[model samples]
Target: RAGLRFITCHEAFASAYSDGTAVRVTTDPERTQAEFARCSAADCEGWRSLVAIYRRIAPHVLPFTNMPLPSGAAAFHALRMAAGLRGAMLDLRHVIFGSSGQLVDRFFRTDAAKGAVLPWGFHQDFGPAVKGGAAFAFVAALSAHMKGLVVAQGGADAIVSALRRLIEDGGGTIRTATQATEVLVEGGRAVGVRTSTGDVLSASRAVIANVTPPLLFGQLLPAHSVPDRVRKRAMAFRYGPGVFMVHLALSRPLAWKAGDDLHRFMYVHLNGKPDEIAGTYAQCTTGLLPSRPVIVVSQPTHADPSRAWAGCAAMRLQVRAVPAIIAGDAAGTIRGRGWADIKDAFADRIIGQLEEHAPGARDVILARHVMSPEDFERENSNLIGGDCVSGSHHLDQNYLRRPFPGWTRYRTPVERLFMIGASTWPGGGVNAASGYLVAQDLLGQASKKAPQRGIER
Candidate 1:
């Protein structure tokens, strides 16, 4: 483990565009209304109302700042308050099933709606079962508006570099390209690990696996070592959805038809009405790729110019809520061809969609790299089915029930074996809550066993 230093950048701007009109989201609450005024006068009032609801509910939903999220009764109470319902019990299931579209519909008139529901879909890792929520979705959007969109100075790789430095400086050795074959269990305890390269590394304290539940229980450990019930639960672990990423080295920045102000934002969501998002989710669940998938167009080079060439820029385009395996194509252009067979065709469709908002996006591309769900799975075994979050964040798969119930504290049935990462509580994103919690628990246990040293007593 390493003690890493982080350099933070401000989330200065973000935007959501639909029907050629863009609503700018800023960190400054006062500027938000003015910014929305640039998009539409009718929607300005709706935006204001949405922000008001966010202010009221955000505090209740995210009660703690620098601590682990509260669970059980306290979590239930917070969720109820966040939902703005008095006397009614609101659980995560209610939130997940409840329509965020309904909440948006209440705040914004049909004509005034500019895809406000889109942010919730993207923010909550929108999937078939995830309908978004009044409390969860609103809080996610509000947090972004309040905190602004922040990124590392030199891109995400900068954080990895800093962590690597910390590890090396602390005399920790890192081995790459070594596949862990089995978790060596001795006397009903996780003692060490055996690698495919015929090397056995022993753990003095514990062995923590930052892997998906299936791999951790099914592959990394002997079949006879794990309990049947635990193995069955792991096998039943459900993945949310996969993402298709296209990284481009643009000859120049995107020229939005709306205005140059679009270049200031870190992310621009290209979505339509709330119903469109719901349709996409439905398609994904049924194993069909949406004809018009939600595209999260990120201009990282706009935030940190150092990432690209002197006169060019770098961009990342993400298509979310797509199936990992190809069952059918909603567009009907590439049916049952599989990701390997239709990855390029799918990328073309994605590029065409981008061109709708940012014209000449295809012409400006100097180079492009595409990663389909299949590619993602090959790159990281833990990303089962290319699910970016490792597992679903649905009601049954989140929080204390994550990776399966009764193992919330990162402990396994086998002593000294622990689990962490996206599959655990505080699921997904750049936040390292899972790792931090596990480290604290391990440290506390270690301190308890330390030999006392008092002068001569």
Candidate 2:
């Protein structure tokens, strides 16, 4: 970078991946128009607040839609005109709190029992944006949980050390890197793992899985090992959208139009509504760009000073629900451009969007970084499709049903192998709730095994 230098990381390490993307769409177009008309007048003041927000946060989200009007009556009338012109207006608040009945509708198809739907408001994780400089907003959720907890960090060594401590506390012993190549089966009991490294770890009691259902039953374990019902359930499992990220280094501090201080709301761009986001997803399936891609940006230098040049700030832009490969086999050949050029294009687009809000923002940057899905996969094997959250946060694939039913625990189909990645419960994030949960299970299992009561199985 021309202006940035880092003391810790050779090149300051910064990553951006879509943590959240919300949409606004109406199944019935006419009704959508009617709602807008009514909202314009009664919520005129709120309307101004919304547009001002978009303009101030431009390049992130533009407040008002097509027929921009200064007054309530005008907004009400303009909404209809814009709709006819294919311009859809949205309220950012609605994305987080509004019930997309559509999302609820999708729950119906999730293969749960009839009438089984994701209980609303239960899908949120407090840690999504905290690492990106949102500690002030999320600190409450931690203390709010009355039952206190402790955490230890150090990565691979830390995980093993924590496990050993739990074991000394009378927890369980772990099999490290056995790679559960297969789940050995004889009489229907899970048995154990046949690791790629040629080690077989067998289970006399229960075998827990550290991987997702796809990896567990499909790859590690043979088809016969899974019961018919369980197999079908696993097959029916669905995943949410993946992510795209862009990292940037600038010669100057990122200045937002709204306020100099970074606001806690994670930045999002909704130039197009739900349809546009879906179109992007569809294109991703066929390897094409969607109608329009959504991006989320954050000014990390705004929070951690160590990320950029002495006076300059660093920023990250992200796209979610996008195809990892777009526009002519995006993989293998990056549209024939080097990574730098590709990243600059993305940054340029973001800056163009910024012009609406902070005009002339593009000139401030000095360096850039961009990562595709392949890039993400290369960096962190845990992030499938570059989605930092592991699996999509869908209802069934979340919480108890995650990675597949009946295997939320960290123990695997093998005896001592365990998973401590984001694929497990309390899914994803640096919080490591899944790891903590696994540790709890291990502690309990070890306590039960310690006395060695004969024939307990």
Candidate 3:
């Protein structure tokens, strides 16, 4: 395997900025309490409420671990209990509600006078996931506080290299630049795959697809081979709002008005009032770019200097809740042109916003690469409109109900065909829970089928 290392940092550890003020969140409960105590009374109360809710849910959910549990009634009951509710019916909105019967945002408005809610939407992709039950978002925040953040020492490429080495060491061959055109099926069983170059690679055991449902059902598989109902579900699979990313190579590190703490934390969220965050999501859903969108500024060079050249920095600006296809601009400044035409102007607007928080952000940029939603789809069809999560995490499409009902265990109706990746349970993120679970299932089946070691049939 490739010799790679990882750098573990505190999870849920981020510095949130609004206007000129800032608040740093960390894993230590006492430290978090002490930090917020200096803020307004309302801010303190809001932070306490979020912590309280997390505490209540922690015992029941065990969000950090990937232990397998029963998928039916027992799972539902445990989830409901974790949210501190007593009933069969439960959703994300119910899970995050405070004692006042309102959402957690009602309690945790950082700038109460300015009406700024905590930017929970930063953890989610779609508008509904932001507007509705942010149960997963809340769990993610709490888990970060509990587990701390873990990153590869060299970078994410370190992970790819390690996996590549493992595959090669195991005598497995990886064909790069090869596109799978169709899944060759024989008698309702997946037998092999036909590549774009017309090479048929047969599968000995199973065909595991990491692509989206649409690509799997519509393009890769024979239309008549799949059931009508399953096909319909794939067609109706909802995708979340796409992402707009700006990668920059900076001549120097960012100079923020908030101080060096900004450089310490890995993620800096730039947002305004809670209402503005909500409005931005609403606008994106309607195919319009928000006048003021929430932006995530990350400086990897701070964590690992090797990422940048000497005396230089490597940074990324990720703007959330942007539309995949542009119909209008809320600021009414950038014309509603296609991504190719408007991406640069949009990047300029985003950079201007960054400059507002970090005064010297624009001056430090030596080179920049912009990846709009369109670019994401062009590069990887799985993105399907630049949705990094693959599919939406709405209530209907989450948990055991994910991908689609009746096929949640990674098995498909077609024999020897399985599915995994972000589209499966334990939904999105860098975690390989889906792949791990699928591997476990396949190993279990293989063990069951193997003949006794001493006495062969």
Candidate 4:
């Protein structure tokens, strides 16, 4: 195992959500229900029932989190899921196929209660109105309630540092600033890589590409080496809504109108009501900037103060459902044609909304950094058009059909060439399922060949 250290999060709250009024979702189920009860007694009961149902189906669904689907595990999960559906016929349909909005509607009556859980549905590129979003929403809320929020002590770079140590300690070399221009092939098999520096580094076993489909197909693997159908599908791979990021170095901590207790939670979502959120999704997908953006404000310093200077806070605002290309502004305030021309103006709108929740928040800002869709692409080519998730997680583009239909097992058309990353199955986030599954598979294949080669470990 790769050794990584994590800081203990706040004991009280997992996150806070607000439409106009705020609701703090506590780590304790009893306390969370109490918060829901403030909305309505029915919501409190609904929350309890939802939790019980999630516990039933989570065992069936969570296995696929760390493993690829369509395997024995997937088949077994399907059988269990089918059984669950039979037991909770009415509720399970909403859990699986209904939009997140509809799923919450079944349980919650007030906007505050619905707003708290609805934002989880937008964890990916999808909106709360999209079908299959309920699955994501349910899983995210359950995970938060069960495990609270976990953060690396020094930030994500700490995890990367640990991985770097692991790789180097295992006698692996990592070359920075080196671009892999081509995957060298020989006799219908991947052999190595040709880098931008005109150096060809040979691989003894396989070449794993942790990149997008477009970069993998015609760009890295030459057209002659790949089948036409595979190449076409890869070329046609769809990217979802672009994401925009704003980092604020606050001179003082944010003062939430809800209370000082709100500062304890790592995430605070400025999620309007369900219907408003649906409209925001509609605006962004159609290439228009939403009048009111759904914002997730992450306060890392709340969990780990080491991330910022003494007495200061480092806040990151994540805005999703943004257009890859700007066509117009729903507010009709900006006249810019592209993200570059309008990012600052758009960021201002985001900051204005933040000010409404936490007054004097803008006054405390010591410094600010904004990354538009174009900026994200420049930072990482895999984030095409600033689509932080790489590819859409829509049912058509996910699971068995991820990256494309013929290439779900991480194996490509060229033998010994493999693909893994956010673009592959079990898609996105920090879960390294694709990497682990591919490694296990390669090891299995190696074990089978070891007997023939007269090799011993």
Candidate 5:
């Protein structure tokens, strides 16, 4: 809470940063803004409990929220949206000899490590989801003027639109059709880029490549400039499976077997237990989706009504696994019994599961968009075949080990070349924290001559 100097619920409608401009929260075009106001700040508010309160609850209590307990069936579903606690739940390796092994006082240390790194970076390394720390970080950056209001291509349309307003407000340039091809380094000195259009645009300050690791090291910078360790690691890097997303326009909000309010966000899926999760991960490791895959179902439409058209809801159902999920190759999979023919046919089965968790699922579904891993790879190269995180988020490939051993802070061996994407540290997604971090590094360098303001976190 102390770190979060500001939180931007909606900026296009209202500049959260006090710049003598604040739009009314209740406005027509800002309907999205109004809806965002309702979606709870699950992180900030839930941190209000005392240490004693936490002592009474650890594994039983979700670290992000202080909500009530979930029923067994609901808890099973919640595992998918978990901050990645599938293995932790069944971990008896270091337990104190045949104890019930519940999350008691002694196990507080398990969550302690989270507190240590978490308070620093927004990518808290929990699980599939984030704790809104990046939002706080970006809003703080905007307020402090450390980073520009201009946020480029963060997957979320709402966030992108608000940032666009800020960029346009600041009279900043929004260059499009400019795909950065290669970094032009002269005698180990940082130079600029060679765009696909053959335009040689030079950065007066720094060269930050906001693309994937393979693209940055392999494509943007030359092979020679990259160190062996970086090269070896990047080469060793595993490009995980693509994600399959099902976006549905529902006719009404979902009805859930709700125990706690937060249960609404709890992800329900098919896989039964740890063995199932393990088997799924194993299948993904070798290249295949688990026979019965685990799916994460998030109804953002339930939380934010503006996400859909009038009388329509948006359903986001996703699963991240290897190519085998989609039968390796769509053509081959379809040729014999393709991933699509199978998955599309099974979509109704998934819908049946959704109907159980969300009573109104089938009844409300008006139109649907099913996205497979193959589809994702074709859409965004950054996704690297639906590995939405640029690359795998495994322990070995995460943190300092990310991209390369020594390269973490967006900088490469070649002078002035920096990185800023999900591929970069504190990796991945709508979190503009990576861009802000990279921007801070760039602005600090840029201010050395251009006279910019003091750098802030």
Candidate 6:
């Protein structure tokens, strides 16, 4: 155990959702449904049905989130999953093939409830109408309900600290500020890595890379060592829409019109109606900055009061589905040439939108920091265009075909070389399943290859 502290978020019950209107939700399905019923009675029944189905299929579906695909366990799990979906077989098919918009349309009757569900899909960095995006959204809902918006106490750095401690305890050295330039190969097998400083680090067994497909194939591994097909596919990996984040150090907590109860929750999704999100995604894909962007408001201080200064709060507004490159502004207002030139204006625009829900939200701001898509890419090259998810989770790019069609096993063409991280199977988020599965594979192989020895006297 890492001795890490956690807050289950049950005490912080309300999760706010707004699309011109507001709905307060909690982990409790019945209570959450009741909140929506105030707006539309039909939406209540639909949510009841959705929750019932979720309860039935969650046992089968939740396992896949952390489990490694392309393994024998996965095949067995699939069989169990099929049995689990016995009555809901047709619905399962629709979930897999249909869009998130369609799924919401099938269940929710009111725009209020639909808006709440639509943004869950946007977290996958795709339009709500994109096929296979519904599954991602539904799985996310299931995960949230199951886990109750879990947060590591003292912030995300606590996770890093725990991992660092674990690695060091295991006699593993961590080199920060060191960039690995190439994965060294000898006799068609990966030996280690050459750092940016040209220092060669040797590995006894394997060299695992936590990098995007493009970086792994195009930059790290020698072109001659990789198969032509694999290399080309990796090179052609598509990233989704970029993210624009704004951090606000508030003199006081946000006063939401939705209710003071909402201040308890960490996250609040804003402007997330189906049509609105669809239009925003279309605008971003066409190289135009969205005039009305979907925003995820995070008030981590609510969940963990220690995260902020005394009597003050820290908030993060993540503007969803933004263009990686500025071609034009959909609003035809801002005429900036680049994201750097427009990010401040964009932050103001976003803050103005926030003010609508939380009256005079701007007045409480102690300070603000904005990270444009360009800034995100500069901070982490893996973000390639600020796609925090590393790569797209489109049907063609996820599941068995993740990273590459035949490379989903994490083992690459080069022996003793493995790939992990957001670019691999589970496809992003902070679950760490990719690394865990790869470690299992390597340990399994090592155990199998261990030579048998006779008992000594």
Worst 10 residues of 4 by lDDT: 11-20
Q: Which ten residues in a row have the lowest lDDT in candidate 6?
A: 11-20
Candidate 1, 1-457: lDDT as tens digits: 3333333324443545545666667677767777666646656787787776556545555543223444455566665665664433343334445556655665565432546444554545653234444545665666778786667776787788888888788898888899999999998899999999999999999998999899999899888888899899988999888988999999999888768778767777776457567778888878898899877788877668888988799998888678887789998887555788888888899899888888888999999999998899999998777788898877678655787887776788889999988888777778787788778888989899998788586
lDDT of 2 at 340: 32
Candidate 6 lDDT, tens digit per residue, 103-132? 899998877788767788898876877898
Question: What are the runs in model 5 whose C-alpha is more than 4 Å off?
Answer: 1-155, 227-229, 257-272, 322-343, 356-360, 446-457
Better of 2 and 3 by TM-score: 3
Q: State the displacement of the C-alpha of residue 66, model 3, in Å, after optimal TM-score superposition.
A: 3.4
Model 2 scores what on Cα lDDT?
A: 0.44
Model 4, range 390-436, lDDT digits (tens) per residue? 89987778878887887887888899998999999888888888999
Alpha-carbon local distance difference test for all models: 0.74, 0.44, 0.72, 0.84, 0.47, 0.83
Tens-digit lDDT string for candidate 5 (179-213): 77788888786688888999898877677777777
How far is 288's C-alpha from truth in model 1 (Å)?
Answer: 1.8
Q: What is the lDDT of residue 247 in candidate 2?
A: 72
Better of 3 and 4 by TM-score: 4
Query: Per-residue lDDT tens digits of candidate 3, residues 12-33?
Result: 4454464466666667777666
Error of 6 at 246 (Å): 0.3
Sort order, lDDT high to low: 4, 6, 1, 3, 5, 2
- Lowest lDDT block of 10, candidate 3: 96-105
Best by TM-score: 6
In model 5, pairs of residues that clash are: 77-267, 242-386, 251-364, 333-338, 334-338, 410-419, 422-428
Q: Which candidate do you rate higher for TM-score, 1 or 5?
A: 1
| lDDT for each residue of candidate 2 in 1-457, tens digit (9 for 90 to 100) | 2122222111111111122212111223333223233423433333233334333333222222211123363466546445543323343333322343333232222211100111111122111211111121112111211111122221124555654676666756666554557877776566666878888777775565545555665676677655677666655655444566767677876555543432222232433233333344455556554334545555544334555568876666666645454444323323532333454454455556554544446777676677766677777554555566667654446545566666555544444556555566555555655565556667877898797657667
Backbone clash total for model 5 is 7
